[model samples]
Target: MSSPQDPYQPGQPGQAPPQPPLPPQQLPGNSGRAFPAPAGTYPEAGPFGLPGQHPPAKNRRKLWIILAGIGGVLLLVVLGIVILINVAGSATNQARGLADGFTKMVIGGQSSQAYDEYLDPALKEQLSKEAFIAGVDTLEMDESCKPTYNDLQVSTDNGVKAADVAGVITCGGKEVDLAYRFEGTEDLKMTNIKLRPKA
Candidate 1:
């Protein structure tokens, strides 16, 4: 029988024998006792990437830059539209003034000056100065009455700007509807003139 202090001694009947304790495992670069891995090693992985790596600062900054670029482009577009509208309005007013001045000069017996200044080069090429003056003379417009314009419309087609002025003027004490078409926003010269006697 084994002594009571023997490590491998069996206990009383129906009891199992005792086994010796296991020796400590010694890894190449570690102490006898194993330690848990460092906190940085073998980081937990998630669907996107490593855990706690969601919403990176670099990606957030890029998103903000993209949004800012879009906003800047939109601002520029709005400013450009505003500038275009103002320019078009200025051109319309200029055209209206030119039409009024030209009509008054012709009816006020300054046909020579009107033909020299207001008529477009293309129109002058079609009608001689003598013919224009003769045509105005036949109208017999009252120089005392002021011409009144009812409507002025400006438009652009294929990069060409044009304006139409429609109004009424007194000729021999009779009201006459007169319409004038002017072309070119910058140069602004008269292209056509029409007179209709009102019944």
Candidate 2:
């Protein structure tokens, strides 16, 4: 006798064989996540060599160094600016002090001393000591006048620094405006002087 009817055999006339289960990708309600591969098998390779691998450690370190260098350069630039500002301010104050001293000496009847010590080479070439003294006597400034400066400024050109100071000197209730230009901060010297009666 023949073997009992094989139920799942293909080409069997009566019954159709059962189908295998569908892959996860084709399954209904699947979230599209792939199944894990067997051990020793790898997933798709990415640009960085592996799917979850990071960039090389050397490259990351280089990036950090570059950023730090930029930060250091910026810090140095800011520090340099601060130092330059301080230097300029110091020079301005020194110039102002020199100007005030010269004015005070001249008003105190020390015109000879003021001219000898404070006059710049350029000014001396233009005005003799006698002429300067004569000019001061013309003003007839009171020896007790106290000078008050209202305008002060400093500038630089071609690596040379100069200061301009304008002030009012009150003598015997009469006010006179005195303006001066001083050159060279290190050894300050009066380059020009203007004395006019206050109107």
Each model's lDDT comes to 0.80, 0.84
| Cα shift from native, residue 20, model 1 (Å) | 40
TM-score of each: 0.60, 0.65
True-structure RMSD for candidate 2: 9.0
Best by lDDT: 2
- Report the lDDT tens digits of candidate 2 across residue range 13-87: 766568786654566575776666556767678788878787789988999999999999999999999998998
Residues 96-180, model 1: lDDT tens digits: 8898888888878899999999989999999899998988777677667567889988888877789998988865567878889
Deviation of model 1 at 47, angstroms? 18
Off by over 4 Å in 1: 1-55, 157-159, 170-173, 184-186
How displaced is residue 66 in candidate 1, in Å?
Answer: 3.5
Name the candidate that leads on TM-score: 2
